[model samples]
Target: MSLETIDLSVTIGDKQILNNMTIKLERGEVLILMGPNGSGKTTLAFALLGHPKYQINKGKIILDNNDITDYPTYQRALMGLGLAFQNPVEIPGLRLSMLLNAIQMKKSGSSFDISSIDPKLIIWARNKTRELGLQPSFLEREVNVGFSGGEKKRSEMLQILTMDPKYIILDEPDSGLDVDGIKLIGETIDSLRSAGKGILIITHHAEITKFVSPDKVMIMSKGKIVDEGGIELIKKIEEYGYKDYEGVQ
Candidate 1:
């Protein structure tokens, strides 16, 4: 009934990026993963989503009591797991609407004529874009092409809304955003959490935490979770910094 990583260890080629990591993300809760650079936060996100580059040396990924350690990326998505990348890739020829339509088909497990697709779905996507403060014309443009930092993040949000996965992983979602952009993204995340979705957000900054309160905050260092606590932990990191936790478990 939950997405859990048990004793997870990930390696890329000869280098080990994550070591004996274990965590659980439950339904209707928000978990924030925070760490300095190279602490394996993004690596954990990639491994959880079955990214090929992150080799799971040991441990299991269970989603709703189903072991998905061997599942492929697309299969994980089909199982209601979604990941929003820190740096979303730009597809020059793929229009936003086209990508959303493809996601809808994948979610429904069936394909119909483009014209026969549900009009309400299209309207929903449009409304999501508008709600995120994006222009309607963005639906016609190529995905992530010529998008500003905030626009790119909003685009990722649009995809997340369209997919409607059971569990969501967002990596550095607040990076490169201005004040207003951060506020908008924070509100969007708040709405998602209120909707009872399991969410794991990765970030180094504490600004976003001001808007969206997480149920748990985990600090990572050198591929291990160094410390875990509530809001007090975030305040400690902001004041004392991560120097004391550099290599300590």
Candidate 2:
């Protein structure tokens, strides 16, 4: 599977968030997007997920060889596109298990028979929770309601792992996570990649890059990808901050 953006651009009100942004993500590969705050990392993620706020002024988004630039958000999701927001909204009154079951139904197009649901799903959720150092009871609680930063990250991972999307875009998954939380997110993402899913992560902390082992890195500045390279760039960014690159390549 693959995702490609061809000269994609977006604007809100009088500000242009993304300008001629083009990127490609292939199967079993992880791409890390790095930039300063307000460099359009989240905007790009939202655009890919077909958010209604960010209007696509020009360009096309092709996913798995299908041109879905015009598809609605739900249509894109049905086509196997998934997003983990930088600030995920809390969906009250919805149990984590129930949400996962709903995703399972959506993916398999199966009847809404909870009895027919695979028992292994529970095991899978349990294992992921343990791996993320979360409590098993989290799966029984309302989705993200009163959850801590780490717990919310775990919830996002659980949803993605269950959905098993072909192309997964994580918008700043490391935003509010600690050391352990970052490691857990990395492990979950690696697990997904091993299953043949392409991953795109938007992050600012180069420290988190150590966990994910990204195949490619893109640096966004002033509404566009100005620099791109291999993992070595991540090391360079960490050792010498991004300011060194300002006004000089």
Candidate 3:
């Protein structure tokens, strides 16, 4: 019933990235993984998704009771696990709607082909884009190409909505967003929670807490969890920063 990592250590190239990282993301809950830069927050996110380069030195990745530590990235995604990159890449020829249609087809187990947009698919994409404050025309543009920072984030969110994974990993979703953009993202998170989706939001700033207070907060340092508690931990980090939090468990 949870996506859990046990004694999960990861390495990239010759250097160790995560140190026995144990964590849980339960259904219908938000778990905040906060840390400073190079604290291995993103590493843990990628490791959980079974990224190829992030070799799992030891430990297990269990999702809904299935051991996925050895599963490939595509298999992990098929098992209802999804990760949103901190920096989304651009696709020059493919349209955003095309990508969304492809995800929808795969998610629903339909035959995959994108010769033309289905009318229903276009309607759905248009509605989602409008909800994100994007013009309908944005859906026709090439994926992430020539998009503003906020637009790109919204585009990523739209893809997530189409995919509709059971669990979501958002890596610094609010990083470059303005006030309005952050609020939009907060609303989207609220919707996801209401839909009973488990979320792991990896972020350095506590600003996101104002809109969506996490059920639990884990402070990560030096690639290991240093502290864990309720919302109070976020407040403490906001007040004093990670300087006093290392090795304080």
Which residue pairs show backbone clashes in model 1? none
Q: Could you estimate the TM-score for every candidate?
A: 0.96, 0.92, 0.96
Q: What tens-digit string does per-residue lDDT give for candidate 1 at 32-117?
A: 99899988999999999998999999999999999999999999999999999999999999888888888898788887445555
Error of 1 at 100 (Å): 0.6
Winning candidate number (lDDT): 1
Compared with the true structure, what per-residue lDDT tens digits does model 2 show for residues 1-249? Answer: 689999999987667789999999998999999877887889999899888888899899999889988889978998999998788789999888888988888788886765555678888888877877888899889999999876787788778878788999998888788898888788778878888889999987876766778989998877888888988877777888677556632
RMSD of 3: 1.3
What value of lDDT does candidate 3 attain over all alpha carbons?
0.89
Which ranges in model 1 have alpha carbons more than 4 Å from their true place?
112-117
**Which of the two, 2 or 3, has more lDDT?**
3
By lDDT: ranked, best first: 1, 3, 2
* Stretches of candidate 3 exceeding 4 Å from the true structure: 247-249
Select the stronger candidate by lDDT from 1 and 3.
1
Going through the candidates in the order shown, the clash numbers are: 0, 0, 0
Q: Ranking by TM-score, best first?
A: 3, 1, 2
